[model samples]
Target: MKATHQPPTTGDTTPADLLRGAALYIERHGWNQGAFFQLPTRHRLAPACAMGALRIAATGTTDSIILDDVFTQVLAAQAILANHLEPDYDHTTDLEADLNFEVISDWNDDGDRTAAEVVTALRDAADTWDRLHPTGGENA
Candidate 1:
């Protein structure tokens, strides 16, 4: 399945949607360890990793700076996903804790990491987002 990056405003695509869509993307495209995306062509998108999926799901582009805005909107959700990747993650002092990018990168780059695990992390993150905002508010 190819990911179509629709603007969030068009269909009530919440932050949770971004997380879930990313998981689904990874499930379909498999995973890549060393890069954010793979097989880039003018025709389709193939997100290669967890963060890459998130970026594609959120903005449909590879410019990573956009991720800062994405993370700011879904911080706790990110934290939940990060904890799944690295159980010992200490958000308090971690250099990139709020975004959880460091832990995610380390986890994905690990030789033992699997695509299923990354997909699970994204789904769990979406679940956490739902629980935190039961009314579908974007406050978190």
Candidate 2:
């Protein structure tokens, strides 16, 4: 008989899970995720507070991620990292120290694997970062 040691489950914070979370947000809000979130666009993901949602709709922004109205920028940051480990940054000079984060990077050719694998890797990375930076998501 072969001795099989199963890898411990991350218990749900994987990137695949995070991407599903993004979908959930869309479903919950009854908005089309494809229409709002453009894969190739480099738009900033600013979470909409209850009041912020009003402003987001009022302003003409084409490419933006519309998440739950309650999530804050802090949560969005964590979510984006967890869902897509290698995410878009407004600029290249951003540093972990400045954001009080430890640098973690994941690279994959877009067609090399399934989206699930990519998302799971990112989820693991973001979870690791969150463990280090435990100051976020309380109210976000």
Candidate 3:
């Protein structure tokens, strides 16, 4: 089933908000097998965007200079996944051509870092975000 992409909007700019948005996007899009075909444009874009926001918060980095790098890493990861899934398919088209993937410019700048390192940092940031913004009334 095809659907129009709608970027999420909210007043909250916290890392938790970003993570939640990412998770929601993934949940709505489905991460299991055969789900890829059903993903909306924004859903395909969420992992990297969410990871970028989490990395920025975790490293306390400024968003200006590092976001490009973050996006690069995200695209790289997507490429890797795409290649893994289908070597003949051009996965970059979805990420590069999608108009809904907005480049965020308002965040602070953190130092340069690798996507591998960012993955670790994103994990910590996600944990912290979850702790700080627990759902179901659970203590953070």
Q: Which ten residues in a row have the lowest lDDT in candidate 2?
A: 1-10
Error of 2 at 93 (Å): 5.1
lDDT string, candidate 2, 15-95, tens digits: 223333433332333222112232322343433221222223222232244434322332334444433344555212323
Q: Candidate 1 regions off by >4 Å?
A: 9-12, 41-44, 63-71, 74-77, 86-99
lDDT of 3 by residue, 30-121 (tens): 32221112223643532233333333332233233444544443343333332323346554454442321222111111234333433433
The RMSD of every model to the true structure, in order and in angstroms, is 3.6, 14.3, 15.5
lDDT at 79 for candidate 3?
A: 32
* CA shift of 50, model 3, Å: 9.1
The order of the candidates by lDDT, greatest first, is 1, 3, 2
Off by over 4 Å in 3: 1-5, 11-14, 17-112, 136-140
User: TM per model?
Assistant: 0.72, 0.30, 0.27
Better of 2 and 3 by lDDT: 3
- Which residue runs of candidate 2 sit more than 4 Å off their true CA positions? 1-20, 23-109, 137-140
Q: How far is 52's C-alpha from truth in model 2 (Å)?
A: 19
Candidate 3 lDDT:
0.34
